[model samples]
Target: MLIREWMATDVLTVDENTSMMKALHLMKENKIRRLPVMSHGKLVGIISDRDLKEASPSKATTLDVHELYYLLAEIKIKEIMTKNPITIQPDETIERAAVVMLENKVSGLPVVNGKSELVGIVTQSDIFRAFVNITGIYRGGVQFAFSLDDRPGSIKEVADTVREHGGRIVSILSSTDMAVEGTRNVYIRIRNLPQEDLENLEKTLRQKFRVIYMVKDILKTV
Candidate 1:
């Protein structure tokens, strides 16, 4: 999925000259953690709640309420904001955005257009929601993990076996990262499986392949 389809378009932004107090207030009122700092309708910097907290007066400070307020008002967002922060294009894939976020150690990225105008924001929450949807977790199907050879038709064989047992496949994901050479790990999510047939299917699958794990709600049946 692309970022434009999932990113929050109605983003809350602040001017570079915005005071720390005002920025903090904006974050609190909107219930968001980060704000894109704009200058002359262009993206310039980014600030987050943590930055504001770090810039704030410490709890043990002897400064009075008026002094604290003055200090906050005098501090501009540009003073502590991350300059020229890492950004992602709206048309970029979600996986690319996730990679950028991981490499930068940031939770969110400002989405920009080709003209460099800020259009939206993509956060960790957005990526997580996309992952859940892609995995079909909410469909609540039985998930099976198997170790299979890397040769052609290996996945098809497992799928054919599942269908033969009257099980409907919901999703299938495979990875070679954790498998030994010449083999890969395949995870399949299936539904419409009868409880009485589960044991026999497991036994049959074990005979043909290595069944690594199975996850299902035992109390529920198709």
Candidate 2:
């Protein structure tokens, strides 16, 4: 999916002149960790809770709570905001945004338009949601993990076995172990089938393939 499809709209931003104390207060009230900084209708920088903490007086200092608040109020977001922060375009695929965040060890990205204007934000949570949806992690289905010969039609046999037992395959994935004597691990998800039929299917699969694991469950959790 595209970044625009999952990115959060109505992102909150702070101006350079905004006080660090004000920014922290806004974040706390909204339960957000970061805020993009905007100036003259342009993206100027990005600030986060960590920035607020860093700008505060050190715990070793003898400043009282009121003194610390005053000191923080004097420090502007511009002083701590990351200038020219890295950004991704809204049209970029979710995978690209995820890769960028992972490579930079960052938790979120400011999504921009073709003109480099911030339109939304894609965070780690968005990426995870995309992954789960794409993998059918929320849809009720059966799951089986087993080893099979790394040869043609080996997967077909397993699939055929499930089909013979009136099971409908929803998705299947395989990982090959080239270092382990030409073996591959396969995982399959199927629509719910009767208990007796599922057992029979497992028994039949074990007759032809190495059955390492078998499980069934409702994919979604309330």
Candidate 3:
């Protein structure tokens, strides 16, 4: 999936000179953790809730409530915001966004266009949505995991068996990470199989392949 499909286009922004108090209010009102700082219609910086909190005066300060509020209003976002923050293009893949987030240790990214204009924002939640959509787990299905040979047609062989047993393949994910030499871990999710048919399929698969585990997942709550 692409970032544009999952990113939040109606993004809220603040100017560099905006007061910290106002930025905090915006975040609280919108239930957002970060805000892009804009200048002349271009993204100049990014500020997160953590920045605001750290800049805020401690509760044990001797200042009065009114005085503390005045201090916050005086501190500009530019003073605390991260300048020239990392960004990603809207057409980029969601997987790429996730990789960027993981590498940079950030939870969100500003989405910009080729012209360097902020068009949207992508967050960790959006990446998770893309992942879950691909897994087809929300729709309720059975998943079978196996250690298959790292060779061509190995996946097709398992898929063909499931098909023969009236199982509709939904998603097939494979990885070589932590697998034995010359082998891969394959996870196949399927739907539309009766309990008896599923059991029969498992028996047949175990007889022919190395069956690691099978899980019948029926979601009770989403």
Candidate 4:
């Protein structure tokens, strides 16, 4: 999947000249965490509610509510926003976007086009949803993860092994590490398998491959 497919397009933004008070109000009214600051039709910075709280006058100061309000009104979005934030292109793969977010330790990323125009925003929740969809992890299917040779028939052998044990394969994925010799990590989703037969299958697999790891999930009758 791509970032554009899962991004939230209906974004709220504020002009650079907008007062900090107004920006905070907009965020509160919209129930959004961050606001993209724009200036002359270009993204200049980003502001979050945390920034507003941090910039507010502390109790140590003798300013009254009215004075605090006036002080906030005098400040601009550009003054407290994070400038030149890391951005992802709309066409970027979801995996790449997730990698960027993880490496940067950010909860969200502005999705921009080739011209650097913000089209939407991608959040960590979007990545998690995409991953769950792609992996079929929530379907109550038996999951198996183990190492296999990269040769063509290796996958067929794994499938056949599952079939021999009456396991219905749902999905399979090879690991991302391609340079690690002839071995590849494989994840397989299957139907239920009995404990004794599952152990037999594992013993058989261990006789063939290295049997790095194995797991069985029994279907619960509700």
Instruction: Quote the positional error of residue 26 for candidate 2 in Å.
Output: 1.3
| Model 3, global lDDT | 0.94
Candidate 3: how large is its RMSD?
1.2
Q: Where is model 3 poorest over a 10-residue stretch in terms of lDDT?
A: 213-222
In candidate 2, which residue pairs clash?
Answer: none
All candidates: CA RMSD in angstroms? 2.6, 2.9, 1.2, 3.7
lDDT of 3 at 120: 98
Residue-level lDDT of model 3, residues 82-166, one tens digit each, is 9999999999999999999999999999999999999999999999999999998866479999999999999999999989988
Residues 18-118 of candidate 1: C-alpha lDDT, one tens digit per residue: 99999999999989999999999999999999999998989999999999999999999999999999999999999999999999899999999999999
**Highest-scoring model, lDDT:** 3
Candidate 1: which stretches are off by over 4 Å? 217-222
TM-score of each: 0.94, 0.83, 0.96, 0.79
Full candidate order by lDDT, most accurate first = 3, 1, 2, 4
Candidate 3, residue 139: Cα displacement in angstroms equals 2.4
lDDT of each: 0.92, 0.86, 0.94, 0.82
Ranking by TM-score: 3, 1, 2, 4
Per-residue CA lDDT of candidate 4, range 60-178, in tens?
Answer: 98988899889999998888889988888998899999999899878788888889898998988999999877867566356777788778898889889878877777678788485
